[model samples]
Target: MSAPSTPPAADAARRPARGRPPRLDQARTVEAALVLLDESGLDALTMRRLADAVGVQAGALYRHFATKGDLLTAMAERMLADCSTPPPDPDWSGRLTALARRLRTALLAHRDGARVYAGTHSTGAGTLGFAETLIGVLGEAGFGPQEAARTALTVVHYTVGHTLEEQAALQPGDQGPADPERLREAVADAGLPHLTAALPVLTGTDFTAQFEFGLGLLLRGLRGLRRDGSGPGA
Candidate 1:
């Protein structure tokens, strides 16, 4: 007979420990990417940098995302996740204004956030849900599907464009005029008659006030469209 076999427990103990690392998924990768993104802008968010931040090898990132573009899209999806919440306002214009404010807040939360948001297609639940809400509001306001979609997109695009300029100006080394007198003098020296006349209000930039003012203008224009029979079902 062969020598007595080792006991089952002893045999199990003799096997080598599994050395593989824990697997990471898309959400975890996006979480790590966002942290890195908030500290450093989009350009610094390379796969190697993200992998290191997440405690994985660079190649492992490809398992969750095929390319950097795919990763950026995921980032954008997370950005809009908070926008999926239901609006508190009953009026269509109020709902649109609230939505615009929420989107602006989201874009301003991260470094270079607008750049990350720009040109990205997010098929994520949050993005779709927010779109559905906006369209629904427009529907309640007597807009057809096409006009409703256009209205929603117009608001979103305006928010994005405004926030892009806001974020860019906030970046390092791009501060606007600190001396009001100098700015006024420069404007006067330029001999821009109309611009000079408007310098008092134009030179002092209050982004919040300016955004709301412009939003009101757009909403007024939309209301005019509906009143004039230029809107859907007109």
Candidate 2:
């Protein structure tokens, strides 16, 4: 019998899928990261966790993404992937409300939920897409470029802020409501009388009610801007 013949390099190259698994792209890696994020909060989303979630080694992730920050940027984008540039509309109030709901839904779906969305990561399409939608909606509301930009920023800022607060206040099936005094004393007695008196009407309610109230106030403020150039419009 001939001595064991070694396979040629070309033959070795033709090795079947039994050797190593296919490589994951940035998106796939990030998708796995998101899944890990949903299952465990951000604090728990180490490379090992993501790798385990994707059925790969931690080192494998570095092939597609450089570091955790890069992974996070991708994950953030994935969270808001469904949202995109807004279209012009006559019923901007409804449009705004819809945007708010969509945003709330997107943020609430993940673990650590809003904690994952605290700040900007400019490299992500998710952030850009959300910004584009808000700007377009505000522009359609009779706002000029600058006005629309600021208004969109404020709207999103408020949404993120409120969403974070809402997420922090409750857990799965916990009836624990927000401490109303937290919202009450937050308003100054002298300079912020309106906010003070409106405290019970505002913070005393459930998150759903509070969300609607704040959104209504935000929209009402825009109405004043629509009528006069006073709101960022000026």
Candidate 1 local lDDT, residue 22: 48
Task: Please report how far candidate 1 places residue 123 from its true position, in Å.
Answer: 0.8
Per-model RMSD to reference: 11.1, 10.4
Note the Cα lDDT for every prediction shown.
0.82, 0.72
lDDT of 1 by residue, 90-162 (tens): 7888998898899889989988888999898888898898899888888888999999999889988998888
Q: Candidate 2 residues 123-153, lDDT tens each?
A: 5677787888877777766778987887777
Q: TM-scores of the models, in the given order?
A: 0.85, 0.73
**Model 1 alpha-carbon drift over 4 Å, by segment:** 1-20, 177-185
Question: Cα deviation of 150 in candidate 1 (Å)?
Answer: 0.9
- For the record, the alpha-carbon RMSD of candidate 1 to the native fold, in angstroms, is 11.1
Model 2 scores a C-alpha lDDT of: 0.72
